[model samples]
Target: MAKNTGASKFRKVNVDEYDEENFQDNEDADVGVVGPNENEVSNFLNQSKNVEALKAVLQNPPQGCKDKRLKDKVVQVVVRVLSAFKTSDIEKGVNALDSQSLDTLMKYIYRGFEFPSEGSSATLLSWHEKVYAKGGSGCIIRVLTDRKTL
Candidate 1:
């Protein structure tokens, strides 16, 4: 009869040596401090005294912003400014945007879809149509594939 040895079955496991929670989640700690300030855009809109300036400010969104909450505030402001524009102005606004601004606008358009309000969808759709016509599918791909969210 062969003797059964527990030594072969069990190797030492230093539980303290291995970290059970080694994974690190993306930090949003700097969200409040970093990214575009809501007041800055709002103030600029006031100072410029023109809705067209909204497009300008949006064109230069805070570089490397990954904060969704901060971006959402800006989008809300954008949608409001967009809503204020006349139908004729919408086309002009879309036309005025450069490729970079178009992509940013597309991102806002998609984000606006998440919280549909009265008549907001129609406005977003109008903007989307104009942007898609101008930028084509590539613009959307860039927005979708980007790791740094607006």
Candidate 2:
């Protein structure tokens, strides 16, 4: 006979051993602070680099069956692009790009990755084309493409 390791023999999550009492708690964590259980948007307001925060999230993310490196790169690229889009100022957007936005954008597009179903990545490509319109106006046509705003 094999020893039982709390989990079901078939690797399913058996709820029988789970402590119902221990699972009930309400401590909301958000953007380096504790608050009520609500949307965690506080980080968006900060002017600091959000990459560190995102890296922390991926460091111990849920174990999935897919290749982690590919998934991580995809997620990272999306985050960089989205981060650029979120910043309101052109300078800030430009700063975000330095970390890796333009390269990521072209890479994602060239790789034939599917467009994100939600959020900024879905909108950024069009937004960029709009900001820096290449209307074939010729004779030194200037495009006002911003770092992240586009």
Candidate 3:
């Protein structure tokens, strides 16, 4: 007698059981639409070259005391953009930043240090260290200062 194998217990599935018509194609499916104006910061960051644009936006922020949310968004965008700066760009970027922009960056860093769990404090510190190493005098001085105003 032939020895029975586990393969003998398996049954072949019907090829016709799968309905191709019922299957949806994800290639053209609309996952979701991302509007340009919806998340300006994310849209700006997604661009190929946005340093100039970011600087312009930072220099001329939205006018109005009620635009606190917009100001926060700008801060978030600045932090993200600054964090993305390469070592070679750090010095130039740091130099180009106005005092207000610097203060904004410092505020974000200070918030991170104040609330370790809420933000990327360590990442910010590392970026500052990188900037310092790359001869970013302004960034180094700003980071070293103990001013609570920022």
Candidate 4:
């Protein structure tokens, strides 16, 4: 046997030291489900401010929204607003949005694709093309990486 020199200190730990009570359960944590303001959205729609409403919806979606029906309602509103835009105005309206708004729009566009309605595919495709041109692939990447869903 070779001569032993203790230059470091270490000890084997007992697995029994870890018990169920040692871990704290976090299942009851408080959750915030912030949805869009209905009155505000209705007001925008009633005023025919589709562009503004679109920007508002994209900028501030219902974070942590759990209700599928609620999300569908919001998506319907967005799709309706998108459909309302005249073909001639699509480019102009899209160009007016800031980068953040553009990315959010891209996110909604993909979400919209999940629930396709009659004639919505073409409109969403138009929007996707325009947003991709302005935001490039980075916008898609951001949308994919983002944890928040609209």
Candidate 5:
């Protein structure tokens, strides 16, 4: 909810005529329910973050996740991200990230290429920016590995 703007001069202001359209977009927004335009709202940090996701990556990754480097990278990424949350929080965090970001992680765990162990920092960062922008949980560790920091 919008913060009370300096409170009302008399702690309450009631106008008989209420025009919702006059309010700014967010002003009329409802939490845990609807967006300003009345679209369904999401719980950003809950649904996506789940213990099952980490477990899923470890258990039945896409394919070819057995490479030591790729395994370590995926493990590190999952561990690092999972470390920050209580077991209960994973589902929420996972839900928050966008599909593309999740796909990147899935690729890393399943099919991401090692590529001669040399590549652009920008390339990795760009990959993760998509991940992070969609609110993915992991930090930029794969970025470090791509840069040979591992």
Candidate 6:
């Protein structure tokens, strides 16, 4: 038998010797779901003061709702934009909303509240209060009472 020693028995790995071509991209990458279009939309919503852009996005969200990742991205963008709205801006936006837009807004509110860590729920609630204060209670009440909303 060989004499005992305190040195490690295992050989050291030389990372530089690994073949790069054989390595595939990680399937579980931490990259988020937001695509370029979603990024553009979120950027426009964040950087632009134009309410019309927001109105357009709210009126017609990107249509891949079947994909949970896409749906989450859409919801995230909407909530971020809505959370940035001022009371007057929200009141004006609420007033300009037709029935369809109102439904969309209600969806946003529901989704916003679904994930509290996003922090948009508080903004939505505050906006609701502002709507009531602006005498738009009927609109909010109609949305809240809608069977499709919950």
Candidate 4 residue-wise lDDT, 32-138, digit = tens: 64445657766787797777766666655654666688877877777877887777767877887999888778877888998888999999999888888888899
Global Cα lDDT for candidate 5 = 0.40
Clashes of 1: 0
Task: Give, for candidate 5, the lowest lDDT window spanning 10 residues.
Answer: 33-42
Candidate 3 segments exceeding 4 Å error = 1-38, 53-76, 114-119, 126-150
List TM-score per model, in order: 0.66, 0.28, 0.41, 0.71, 0.24, 0.55
Tell me the number of clashing residue pairs for each predicted model: 0, 0, 0, 0, 16, 0
- Report the C-alpha lDDT of model 3 over 21-56, residue by residue, as the tens digit: 666433423323221132564566667345654464
Clashing pairs in 3: none
**lDDT of each residue in 33-83, candidate 1, tens digit only:** 443445665665677444555564575554356656766677777787667
- List lDDT for all candidates, in order: 0.72, 0.37, 0.51, 0.76, 0.40, 0.62
Residue-level lDDT of model 6, residues 1-150, one tens digit each, is: 988886774567666558796665434334343233555556666576536555755755433334566667667777777776775677776677666666666666776776676666678897556545544556667666754322
Clash pairs detected, candidate 1: none
Note the residue pairs that clash in candidate 2. none
Q: Write the per-residue lDDT of candidate 2 for residues 1-150, one digit (tens) a residue.
A: 998678756777676658786574333323232111112222532445444333332233212224456544545444443444443543334333322333333333333234454554545554344323322222112212322111
Listed per candidate, the RMSD to the true structure in angstroms reads 6.4, 17.0, 18.0, 5.6, 19.6, 15.4
**Candidate 1, overall lDDT?**
0.72
Model 3's lDDT to the true fold?
Answer: 0.51
What is the lDDT ranking, best to worst?
A: 4, 1, 6, 3, 5, 2
Better of 3 and 6 by lDDT: 6
For candidate 2, the clash count comes to 0
Judge candidate 2 at residue 95 and give its lDDT: 38
